[model samples]
Target: MSEPHAGSCRCGLISAEASRAPFWTSYCHCRDCRKQTGAPVMAFVGFRDEDLTWHGEPRSWRAGGVERRFCGYCGSQIGYSDDRLPGEIYLALGFMDEPERYPPALHAFEARRLPFLHIADDLPRYSGFSVER
Candidate 1:
């Protein structure tokens, strides 16, 4: 059976479920990503817009040419969507119930990676957007 995947915000007030698997997953090291996640890097999984469902209202704002969504109650980031990539929704890996199941296959915005941060894995690295690089 295809076990569905689930996730929630820090306060558990914002929850979501994915009926199908994601299309791609990656670790992003861009300055915007770091600032949004408040981490050295941000991990995300991309799913078709139709495959995911949300349980609560999320506040959103435009940043770096994309719409960033987060839980209004807990200030937890929920996901992001780019106008250029229609039909796709990217979600935070940390919020996933089983984040390990969606290991990042590549690192995006490698050029922006912090000088002090280093990812030990040898996964493919892209200087910019993985899909474009």
Candidate 2:
């Protein structure tokens, strides 16, 4: 088996590893993401929920229909789970040990995207949500 990609929270109370590389990387520009991240966009990596293992139990909160998890000590946003996307997990890119390794392949919620943030990269951009190529 290949080496897993490891990550941890700021306080070291929460850590995680993925058996495989991320299935997808994306930048979300929705209002909810911006408010949560306190940034113009929020970066995330998608993987099978079962593929991710945590070293410690994380604190969870419900936002809409999703369960957002974070380190209770450091308040680092770690990841999230949603019943709408069974068998999959969404990890906050900021929590990655090597965040630069995961470049966003797509931009979502562009309709509500902040006007001050300019993304010059050539990755595909979408107005809202999308589930297909």
Candidate 3:
């Protein structure tokens, strides 16, 4: 059985619950992600959109064809949507209440990764999404 996972925004105004395991988890090093997260890379876990239930509507913005959603009150990034990947939602891994439970299995956009950011030697690395590799 999959473990139950729950999390909320910094201000607790927005919350979500997922009853199943994540479909996939990855670290994204794309320039856009670096800028959005203000970190070396952004970690994310993919889930079926229908499996997630939010407490309220979050503010959203479009970037590179993906709709990024965040808490309206705290501005904490929550997830993102892409029409090309119907039925799939990508949640920011850091937002999880226990983020350590979901370590990224792969690294994407390695070409754009920062020079000083060094990932562990184990996880698979790709220039872009694995689908494109």
Winning model by TM-score = 1
Candidate 1 residues lying further than 4 Å off, grouped into runs, are: none
| Best-first order by lDDT | 1, 2, 3
Ranking 1 against 2 by lDDT, winner:
1
* TM-score between model 1 and native: 0.94
Q: Mind giving the per-residue lDDT tens digits that candidate 2 earns over 1-133? A: 3766878899999998998999989999988777777778999998887888879999999976878888989999887777788888788999898998899999998888878889899888899874342
lDDT of 1 by residue, 23-119 (tens): 9999999988899999999999999889988888889999657999998888998889998898898999988889999999999999999999978
TM-score of 2: 0.93
TM-scores of all models? 0.94, 0.93, 0.92
lDDT of 2 at 61: 90
| Range of the 10 consecutive residues with the lowest summed lDDT in candidate 3 | 124-133
Record all residue pairs in model 3 with backbone atoms less than 3 Å apart, i.e. clashing.
Answer: none
